[model samples]
Target: MTALAVRQIGPPRLTKGLESAGRLDWDAHRALHPHPRPLTTDQLIALCEAGSLHGRGGAAFPFARKVKATADSAVRRRKRTVVVVNGTEGEPGSAKDKTLLRGAPHLILDGAALAATALGSLEIIVAVTDPDAAASVQRAIAERGLGARARVVRLPERFITGEGGALVRGINGGRPIPPGRKSRASTRGVDGLPTLLSNAETYAQLAVLAGLGPHRYRKVGLPQEPGTVLLTVTGSARFPAVVETAAGAPLGHLLDLCGSRAGEGVLVGGYHGAWLKGEVATRTQVSRAGLAAAGGALGAGIVMPLGRGTCPLGECARVARYLAAESAGQCGPCRLGLPDLAGALTALASGQDAAAARDTVARAARMVTGRGACAHPDGTARFVLSAMDAFEDDIARHVADGGCGRPVLGVLPAATDARLSLEVDWSRCDGHGLCADVLRGTVRMDEYDYPVIPSEPIPARLEADARRAVAACPGLALRLVPRTAHDKPRPEPQRGR
Candidate 1:
């Protein structure tokens, strides 16, 4: 894990003492934020409504509506309501939630306690993927004597594990992947009871709201979306820090604070986000409404401006491949369409049949939208389509010529685990052609029908198929192995004749 830099653009609220050191103790946290009077369920809902509090998770759903839905479900179902705190910060480019979970666990707990108490709920579950965050939250729960009422659960580290329904399923001891079905967490969650599930930052904001009330909280940010927001600044940023700022702050100012030049373009949100031209990103504001107006989103509060050192199209293609690999594999759009979309984008980025690749990318994106069980396909489509729009000039150059003249420096981050290749045990081989049959793109059969594995790392689109090939080998001769320095780099797809 990278050492995160913490900074505040304005008067610090959530990140007040975060820069100083390790996790803040309960006493120190209380000293900074004296406990306010406990809010009733209605008061809490009213504060959220007035403040326009939204989930810090990618969706930016209204917190008040989610709360009311959970409360209503609990009343109607005659079951105890469960409060779930999602600290699973699965976005590779975002670290805001982890910063909050590790630095100010108490604040999150305070918010969760308020909701759980008001909802007449007995259980408060904090689900986190980072070990440090889990430990910090566990210590905070112990310090507050919330052992009986609150507990911390460590979930698997995956891009989609943080989805509300997925987190609920994981907490119920199932695989932490999207269920491929739309089910509200409010109605059926954690032991089949009504649940109030929200992002870690959302709950932390509630704690702040409880302390300052809606009027004071509205003083700092825009009138429409009051209060501060936490953002993870990456890519060309000099600081690459988790920044706390007013919700409607200028995007350019944040870029300047992080020492970004906005070289080629800026990616707002995360992998499942859109790209904005440099000038457009500079003029945009760091709010949902503002970003939406600029053809982007404030999803998960991630802002990454591309630097000139790398090829922008290549970086987008890299992340597109990663998003495709991270799919839940539960629906056809995610399992099949996303990989196809990624391959097309990769081909376009490689300057291979640029016009056709672009068309394929656009077509695949359209085919997958709104067809998945979750928003994975839609978000991935948004990311790829936005890249096509934002990098049109570069695509034209790549089409006219065969190169971008810039190396793919890999400025955009993705999971390191995706660097894998296939190996074969020749001694155990029975000339089975299953591997070639499954991995049609990367594997081929020799004259004797023996599998001929490529030395280069498997392409992201073929990783799942590679695994299936390994499993399907009759002689158990094939295995998936991590690519090392000795392995050859992934070869670019063949260009059009």
Candidate 2:
């Protein structure tokens, strides 16, 4: 993680070039920050509107829109607003946020401060879980003596903890899971005051643009807007690193940097992303516009490797379960639906009935969707459902012949990781039937038996039932497995019958 000198500049930033992705310490951002008057909210909005800067965070929601939403607030008496820098990088496959937060903390801070100034905020919190990232940001804060106005907050290590809203919850000492309902962090956030939350890179980009102004910023990228974007190229790369390329840099140019050695197909945007069979150089453009052309998103700008060695269906099943378990469990569709959806994938991956699997998937999609409070459930469902569509051929093979030719490589996270294990304390088992009633997909009553448990993963629609199983467990044998890498399923003496 040492910073190596890349060629020239000002503030030190990290980049994964085609040649080398190692940390480089070139001073591209060391120039004096011009002490321009803090732009009025309208001026800031114009700067964003002129620059055409998409959200550096995956969502690409216009920064101008978020600013307009929060900055234009009409609350009679406003609570002191806080601006949150989300650096969780929760997606296991994405590393862009961590890279920016670790290497260019000051640039991010400068941008956040600019935003805070615009929003009438006095406090800025740079939140992250990665050790190196946290330390880097903290040191930058201390070195600049910006500690009073800007601070760094270390967070509990977990995947779901990175969700935008979840990160807000983490900051306030609440559980880091997303809530059952959607509330804009910019509206009702951080100590019940309207907070402006954005990914770390968004701030960095804002800083860069603030320093350069809209005209200079528009020089490099498309005329539709102007500016560059940073992306983390992973999967199969000769020398993968963070890249500072033109906004909507053609994937071809980036792939050229990758050269011949890249995994066949790719997963764009990270874990909460989509998988496709293609490369960047020839077919697709890399801009939000470009990615949209490819029917994909430039989410968090993670270019993951979809190596050919893994079975696509098995891979889908694996990640599906992880995504399901990663749910904040606040929304009904995501909590109940994801598990069921993931289960269907597991069943298909293991050679279950194809027709039944398809029907079950369709049903799960219908039941758990639109019922969630957050987009997590909806996004997870979209990912799984799209995967099924994307790799229908492999899925058919899993059903008709019981397997895809490729081995189930660990490219995707485990599908059954936390979902299959139903830990009910025998002593606590009152046989009250709540767990069974709630999670019939997992547990059921058998003749003279406490509960019949299925060893397989649950469906997405049944996620609520799983939670209810945990909540309703009379003996409190049921417990939720928080979303974390260490959550391994427990082994059992008796197997599912």
Candidate 3:
């Protein structure tokens, strides 16, 4: 909610022709990017395919393929196609989308309008969780006289609420969680219409790609990833800014530009992304393929340098605990397994006979992978497992004598538990076993057939089932309660001298 100074680096395609003078208003944006070329569906798809444009969202899916699928589905179903610009920016430590939306709102609106027009749709929805971003977008829409074509909808600031299907469900007045079954928003989204949903940055890139075409757009970045990427550079850096860099820019170069020194490690992507050691960081490239080769990902365009002096293992444990709490509680493996993994990591961090705990963490990470309704469990597994490999020596030292003698600086960010958590009133409870049956992992039966919950906070994944159990409770015992502010972790400790 605070005002963040967003600065760019490299040639700056998406954020091109702008300076830190201030937010680029509608008139300035129109002047900079004059008369964007309007393209039909086929023309847009051809340009995207030629440029090999990919989603800036964590998945890195082929953008052209999504367009083709949505267009084809729309034609076949005789349904209107829709465009949803995702500005949820739910990934912690990532602020590029918000930066783009807030700084250059017109650019995002142009891209969304382009997509909607190309797909023969008249509707575009820009979903944002940040109040400032929403206000900026609304003002841009009004100024551009795009009131008929596009609208901005504010969403609850939660991690999972940003997901494509979950956002669609929320927009359509359903609970903001992915449906139990696997379904693409392209096939059914936003009032059962075929929808083309993508990250807000992706749409901004679309606007750029539309103007530049395939040739000029391919000039700066790699051939594989032929465009610039916006990265939110943070963690132990002298200057934390939203950086725009070419796709193939060396990871270490960005680190140096962000004021990172030698001996520092980098967490490529975001929390669910991998942590590469300093040596690996130098060799790593900013593109997806390059990062893949370096055992990392260009996820959500987040590049965080882990400076010297902090404990990588301790930081991993803290992030793991936060990830466990953010689970949508839709699947058993994620709802139960993540907390177990976090517990194991916590034991390891505290130096409490950690070898067994380390093994437990590893096994739990593997067990939870590919078992969730969404990619949350799988991505989280990758994050935890990668920490194990990246910090192998630290794990070894901790297991040998309990710890590596370093403090957790909390470099990674996570949302505090601000939502309502399920609560039980003892006077209203009548030892109903139904709550335990419906919410198996969350509600356990006590000796008297009453539900006994652990002191740990319940994850969002289990919230739906918890509500179901509450409704099933004949005694009207269960209710949702806001967690205490004290439950939040302390402010991040300062790193470096």
TM-scores of all predicted structures: 0.90, 0.78, 0.86
Name the regions of candidate 1 deviating beyond 4 angstroms: 416-419, 422-437, 440-464, 467-480, 484-497
Give the Cα-based TM-score of candidate 1 against the true structure. Answer: 0.90
lDDT of 2 by residue, 303-416 (tens): 755555666766766677667766666656765677678777666665655567777877887787677776676667667776676677666676677666566646544343
What ranges in model 2 sit over 4 Å off? 1-37, 236-239, 259-264, 279-282, 413-497
Each prediction's whole-model lDDT (CA): 0.84, 0.66, 0.79
Residue pairs with backbone atoms closer than 3 Å in model 1 (clashes): none
Q: Count steric clashes of candidate 2.
A: 36
Give the per-residue lDDT of model 1 (tens digit) for 1-497. Answer: 46488988889999889986467889989998868677778987898898889988888889999999998998898889999999998898888999989989999998999999889997999999999999999999999998789999899888888988889989999988888788999999999999999999999998999899888989999888889989999987887999999988999999999989776689998888899999899999999999999999999899999987677777777777677767787888976787678767776766766778889889999999989899989999999899888888888877777557776765777663446878889999998788866764245555466765644467554677889998999999999887776643443332222
Instruction: Give the range of the ten consecutive residues with the poorest summed lDDT in model 3.
Output: 488-497
- Quickly count the clashes in candidate 3: 4
lDDT of 1: 0.84
In candidate 3, position 450 carries an lDDT of 73
Give the candidate number with the greatest TM-score.
1
State the lDDT of candidate 3 residue by residue for 231-258, as single tens digits: 8888777877788888887777877877
Per-residue error for 332 in candidate 2, Å, reads 2.7
